[model samples]
Target: MKVVIFSTCVVDLEFPNVGKAMVEVLERFGCDCYLPSDQICCGQPTYNSGYEKGTQRTFRNQVDALLSVESDYIVGPAGSCVAMLREYPELLKDDPEYLGKARILAAKTYEFSQFLWRILGVENAGAELNGKATYHRSCHMTRLLGEAESPYALLEHVKGLEMVPLANAHDCCGFGGTFSAKEPEISKQMVDEKVRHIEETGAEILVSCDPGCLMNIGGRFNRLGKPIKIMHLAEVLNSNVDERRITYLKQMPV
Candidate 1:
């Protein structure tokens, strides 16, 4: 499949590895992924903060960068950015020109898991890594885009993955983009709960669909003392399966 990747500003700058991992996985899945050099922010922050007019200039540029490619879809590694683009049309209801573009972009825009499971129509992609994992259902993905099963469906077919359910899974990690800044104490409280759930699962890798949530919770895990390693969903799926096919002798739990 030919597609263009919409790398969010956060992933482009701070979490470049996430973007790189996304491309690697798509390539492995037989996709021709293209990146637009001029792509910038998805205007999420400003738009979410009731500054729709302020977001127009950036949104206009985003639409242009995405339309520059003649591909089947515009895929984004970050669920938040994809959801933002999908929501743009409603926010731009007053302007038909931009609204039309936003609707077109929304039609073609899809989150990673969405594209993999829906468009590609293959779950259990030929990846086998033997280990227990817990998936963090990102808020933007679950609440905004209503994409709940895509992540789980992908994990079900991972070469040797055992998905452990997260406790209180629907609760937010408190990292609603700038919401953490607006409410630090509450955000930290939510992170505490999320980390606590990861510990309960007894999983080595705590996987999440969004980098932003991982940033908040992972930072907290780094602060105190935690052994659990955090991984973006793309990174987990991008794992090199060459060595993972080997099974290790299990030690009986006492």
Candidate 2:
């Protein structure tokens, strides 16, 4: 399948490796991937902050960039950003020029893990990581994108990896984009609680599908002098891959 990669701002600015890993994994699955040079932020940072009017141009720009090349799918590493991309249809519904384009863009977009499990029918990527780790479910991914299982399903197949249950895994890490910036003290307390729960799991590494949450919780860990390692789901899934063990579902599910 031909895939267009939607590189989010966080991945482009802070977690370039996660984007690279995502591309590697997709290519491994025989996807012809294209990264649009014109792609930019999905406007979640401003839109979520109640700047919907100002975010329209950003939404249009992203649509134009992703559609610049015809592809079967538009995949992204971060669920939060992917969710934002999926909202373009509704966000621009009233725009006569962009509404139809927005719908087409939204229809083909998928978060990295979601595409692997749902579209590619991949059960295992043959990754091996020997360490205790717990996953943080980002609010946007779980609630907005409605993808609560794809990450866990893929993670279950990673050899030598121990997945621990995170306490209150559904709780937000307080990185609601500008929310963390606007309410620093509140954000700190929320992330502190998140870190405390992560510590309770006794996991050596923290994993999450959303970079913002990882940045929030990981930053809290750093400020508190915690030694826990942080990793994005793409990075974890791309580790020590064994080609011989890679397997896909016998049939793609509806």
Candidate 3:
């Protein structure tokens, strides 16, 4: 299958390695992956802020870029942006032309974990990272996209990963794009509570699919200088086991 990688803006700018990790994991699984250079924002910011006209630039930009790729699928490590693309037709309700095109793009979009665990049927995707970890279920993945189990399914294969239940894992991390800017105090408070949940998990790694949540949670962890590690889902999937396991695996590549 030919899959195009849509590295969301946050992942592209802050956690670029997540994008690389995604490409690596996909390639490891034997898919023909293409990264289109001209691809820009998915227009979530403008669309979210009630600026349909403002989004025309980015929305139009994305359509133009991907339309040239000739790929059968477009995937991203984010749920929010995909959800935005999926629901953006409402923003273009008056414009039948753009709404039709938006619907076409939305139908083909897939969140990375969803693609890996469901569409790709990679129950035990051959990636193994040993650690106690807690997953922060981003709002987009849970509420918006309604894709709840893919991450757990993918994580089920990580060599020795202990999946601890996060208390209120369904809650928002408060990195709501413009939400953070307009209400900084509320956003900070939400993240503070989220950090407590991570601590409660006693997990060495705090993993999430969205970089916005990662950034918010990671920021607090850093400020507290907690021994916790914040990481993207792609990072976890690309992760191989430690030195001892690699030596053992090469002796018998599972």
lDDT of 1 by residue, 22-56 (tens): 89878877799999888898997787778877888
Clash tally, candidates in order: 3, 0, 1
Write the residue-wise lDDT of candidate 3 on 1-254 in tens digits.
Answer: 89888878888788889889898878776678988889888787777788877887787777667656777788898888777667756656677767777677778888898887766767665567788999999998789998888888678767878989899887888899888888989988998898888898889998888888888889878988888887788888777733333211112212
TM-score of each: 0.90, 0.98, 0.90
lDDT of 2 by residue, 1-254 (tens): 89999989898999989999999999999999999999889998888899989999899899999999999999998898898888888899899999999989999999999999999999999899999999999998999999998899899999999999998988888898999999999998889899999999999999989888988888889989999999998999899999998998787756
lDDT of 1: 0.82
Model 1 regions more than 4 Å off:
242-254
The lDDT per prediction is: 0.82, 0.92, 0.80
The model with the greatest TM-score is: 2
For model 2 the local lDDT of residue 104 reads 93
Per-model root-mean-square deviation over C-alphas: 6.3, 1.0, 4.9
